[model samples]
Target: MIDNSVRTLFLLKHSPYPPMGGAPLRNWQNIKAMMQLGEVAVFSVSSYKSPRSREYPPGVSLWKDYSTGDILKERSLIRKISDRLWWMRLYGYPEADQFYGDRVAQELQRLLVEFAPNIVVFEEIWLYRYLKIIKPYGCCLIYDAHNIEKSLRRDISVSEHKPPFVSSLSGIKTAIIEGYLVQQVDQIWVCSQQEAHLLQKLYRQIPPTHIVANGVNIADYHSDRISHSLPTDGLEPNHFTAIFTATFSYYPNSVAAQILIGQIYPQLRKFYPNCRLILAGHSPTPYMKESAQEDSGIIVTGKASDIRPYLTAASVVIVPLLKGGGTRLKILEAFAAHRPVVSTTKGAEGLNVRDGEHLLIRDKVEDIVAGVCQLWSDSSLGRKLAESAYKLVQQEYSSTAVRQQVEQAVLQLLPSDFRF
Candidate 1:
């Protein structure tokens, strides 16, 4: 029995499940949160995860693509050619995912025709190829610009080993297509004002955008206690403890680690001789694994199935990101877990965080050393910063507050007052 009083929202994304990457994680959580507001019909490309693993909320209906099994596999020749053609649209050229058409396109067509949702929410512009089929329905379109897609690619190309000309070409082409895509959607949602403003600054004519910073589930994070697996190697007596949340898989995280381990950690050790830097995340790359094995004061846990132990064990959390976009979920987790943080301007790039009040921020290594030492030497200051951080998370980034903003946005998109 369908409820005529409830509005229907079609939420679509490039992936069906969460926990694989940052964007998908935020999108999945937002979808679950949105369901609490109204009935939702989700359409996504499931080529990345097993369909059985996808958890769809009770009131949210779902539609997915079965065209491609897993995006990590090899494809047929013609299919590969088609993917290459599609990839050039936003990415500006060929890449792995480009060699295959996201199954979301086919499934989106099916969903729009059958379900006819009142509002259609897209997780990323990469799924624009499917818009041609659903646009005629005239439903409100909410485009969640995960990042200024082109700006992210431009930053990524800097660290890439590709030829200079190739990088430039890709950057130019991506900018053009993404600029056009920005104009097509009715409204946009982003993880942070930094990201939302970046898109607005880039296109200069983007639709109304909102900053929906990622929220932490304080209860879920507190459920687990912090523990350490590092053998009490003689270096364990460090007075200053710092932890970084990241995986070697992402360029920004890897680049931050390169600097933190290669540069900042070394500098901090001089001031606090026993300073211990803990790096924990999923999939430690080959380079990361080798670096971890080195006799340096850095302790690297390649892939911790649980990061709560690492977060809990630390006196301070550092988000020394050198590049990239979106809100830093790691910083929020650190704050909610009651750990003080020291981040570069880019590390604390988004959200309504206040420097020194919520978390400390420094750009230069000298400043980073000073910030860490200042917090490390004074237990009262460290405890005060930790308390302030937890309060900041509670005040603004709470799920309740964020959900209010999301519900308001969704309600505005609805054609009339309706309930689910």
Candidate 2:
């Protein structure tokens, strides 16, 4: 019973067509779930040049797509700085003005007038800048909190060894912006209960919050359907392989990749000489690329179009993240692919799974290496963990589960008399 009359619009910071990384994947999944509710339109503004695809996800009407790079190229340096200064004075942060220019605002206003959406969903906190434009439209507003930005910024600063004063200021500014954004929205959608609780603790007079957990497409990552072909070189079918996949541009993932190369893999090779390490994802750092070149056993696959091949070739998936906010979608992908995972406590945050029951939870370098080696020596242990994890994904973190959550949360915001 699809309702054609219920128009819902999504405001995104990036296009989710191909969904290469976590944020885009979540956006894509959220868009798909919203399609079940009514007519859906997306307006995305990308800060960088992303690879565009002709084949978009079915059932989404792309109202407008803009690239910040293209928009700002012709603008004068003085003008850009002026805009930033003006935005900082008004909003306490210049990110909104930095990402969206006058042209973008004009076009967005035109979309609002024509589309006349019944509901407006802001994909992430960055889009909070457009709230002023959206409020007058009289549409129900939903803010999707991808992460508690303040906490995430603080974590990143600490991990990157940023100065204490700089980190504190950044955190404070983010808290002020995010705190205001949450209070303005009709309802807030968070990735986990932990995030919902954190929001409640941080902000006062916030709207109703719902936990719509991050999910993976079960069919896409099913063990039976994944290909055996390795996507990168330096690995064979017989080689014991460990894989870590993420958008390496993200500060946390980049840090984890450094730890894997600098600390984990070297120790791992001592235990298993045939061991191979693969870092598969987009925007890997130059350090990673150089290390891959220097070490024959390490393969860094940049911007994988499809990750299933790498996952299929992996003996175990590793997530040694020291700092992160949301649940790891990469872990769920590995679970759906029927691969054993070894992660730190921070890496497995927000997920409802025991350390020894679903996957090995190890924080120390020696412990992680030992866990991987134990799995290597005893195939039964890996299979047992993988089986349990696969079942967990099916029950709690699959696309179907997420869609149901989204439907329930969104429906609660609609008027009692409204029907689909």
Candidate 3:
């Protein structure tokens, strides 16, 4: 007989609270959904350790915070060097912030015995190594593939024009690891059907997969409707403000910011001098800060406590991402906020939104500029698009719709007689 009160342990690299990007927002929403089904606890490493670290999700039964330093100290000098080299060569990121292995395994072992969770959900592939520890416990393992990481890296390699030799080696290693993990996990959760199909082609032994597209917390956005508050600082009164929000640390988003200020803004300025561009998100690269300082019309809000104020203030939101995997949560947020969006075709890739009805989709610089200009010039058109997008989000991408999918998927993995 299946247990009615099932328990889950969710593992992620970073705390899902204070979500600033697409992936974190998904993590946050997924965790919220998990709580409604049964008891839930989170295991995560601190991105930055502090005495004043805030509690996430408020009333979770357990929240364990591990340190990267603990993991590093357990490795030999040569091993550390080798790992550093591998990370740099594979992901082009030298920092070992997201790496977890044997050092974490011991703590994980203790947690597993104490929690005795029936289900263990990993946030992404990087946490796949933990499966070794999880397997002996016989807990059902779910690998939430945020995107086909191997393919995403390959795209990044090609986009950044990495050396052919380096790209080939990285691609081979990534594929081998990802393929191995796909075979090991009991279930694989993907964000889109396209990603699921792609993974199946890439890995012949792929496990049963489910599509759980990222959703917006409609309440988070709707709260804005009730509150007419705007940020006291960092926002200037502009006649027409076109805003783009993305975590600046990501290469694609950083490139998009550059494109916005460099390529698109020039064309846009020719027609509307009073218009301004706002790039808001965490970790503003030095180049972005420098570019913003150089151009008076561009405002870079490095990071903000809340994004709704910016969204509420935007005349139009733009998603000019050139390349990335998975659906864009930013678009969903725009829709929830009832803000008209102008995005590149790639930006709206996995969303079930119509271009003309929900948001405008444009690819080239000229077309992107035209879309934003059209929205700014035509308030009625913007209102229609925003209203349509909001309705679509309410019916499709709302937390209620997505949480049900998650609940069914979780139940399917549980014992046959499992009750709510």
Which candidate leads in lDDT?
Answer: 2
The whole-model lDDT of each prediction reads: 0.70, 0.84, 0.79
Candidate 2: deviation at residue 39, Å? 1.1
Better of 1 and 3 by TM-score: 3
lDDT of 2 by residue, 1-420 (tens): 743366789998877687888888888889888888787888888877555554565788755888878667756787667765653454556555556666787889999988888889897787777888889989999999888887898788877777787677667777777877888899999998988888888785789899899998888875567564545455568447999999887889999999999999999989888788999999999999999999888899998888889988888999999996754898999999989999999999999889888999999989999998988888999999999999999999999999999989877998765665
Q: Candidate 3 — which residues are off by over 4 angstroms?
A: 1-4, 46-53, 81-98, 223-228
Clash number for candidate 1: 3
Error of 1 at 308 (Å): 2.2
Ranking by TM-score: 2, 3, 1
- Estimate, for each residue in 67-170, the C-alpha lDDT of model 1 and write its tens digit: 34554354668666666575344543443243235444555666777777777777666555556667888877888776777888888898889999888877
Q: What TM-score, over all chains together, does every model reach?
A: 0.84, 0.94, 0.92
Judged by TM-score, which candidate is best? 2
- Give the root-mean-square deviation of each candidate in angstroms: 4.0, 2.3, 2.9
Which residue pairs does candidate 2 place in steric collision?
none
Per-residue lDDT, model 1, residue 14, is 42
